[model samples]
Target: MTSTTVRPDLDLTHARWQSGTQGMGDVEIAFIEGYIAMRNGGTPEVPAVIFTPGEWNAFVLGARDGRFDLT
Candidate 1:
């Protein structure tokens, strides 16, 4: 949920994807044109979800604040 507009014209063909140190099942992320692209590491064939800088920050903040905790 961001107030900024997303850049759909950005190309991710050469994007170098990164993942956490948790080994096999971790998700992948790529930084491209000031936006964050996320995708499943286990299934790279699936298209990625793009997020604006503000949306990425908000997601990180929410994760750090335990808003995503299921317990």
Candidate 2:
């Protein structure tokens, strides 16, 4: 996992974030620089995961293709 600084001036509380599964209302995704930052709901101060551009692209493609779907 990679770590990056989220802009303090930005407010992510109301930002929209989606995870692989439902029922997680507090999850949010933010693209910062060359990485994708995922923050848990109500915890904007911390990031759950920071994916690199390549990793982010792979995840996007996988999700699009339903590769992450539970079998």
Candidate 3:
């Protein structure tokens, strides 16, 4: 299983709640060398999903190929 982490600090009160947009509309996507992070745009001071870079890339590719279709 891919190791993941959720940021312990972030706020999501004003983020534009979006769905089917990576599972959360209020979230934003970002990444570093070995970690991918999804955080609430409105509340950047609350928790968010963090995944290994590899896993994040895989998900991206899958989404590109219709593998992550929400419908």
Per-candidate TM-score against the hidden true structure:
0.79, 0.50, 0.49
Best by TM-score: 1
lDDT of each: 0.87, 0.67, 0.62
* 1 against 2, candidate with superior TM-score: 1
| Local lDDT at 35 for model 3 | 58
What's model 3's TM-score? 0.49
Task: Select the stronger candidate by lDDT from 2 and 3.
Answer: 2
lDDT per residue for candidate 3 within 43-70, as digits (tens), equals: 7777767667667888879979998688
lDDT of 2 by residue, 1-71 (tens): 99764544444445556664676466667765555667776866674577777787898899889998887
Which pairs clash in model 1? none
- TM-score, candidate 2, is 0.50
Candidates 2 and 3 compared by TM-score, better number: 2
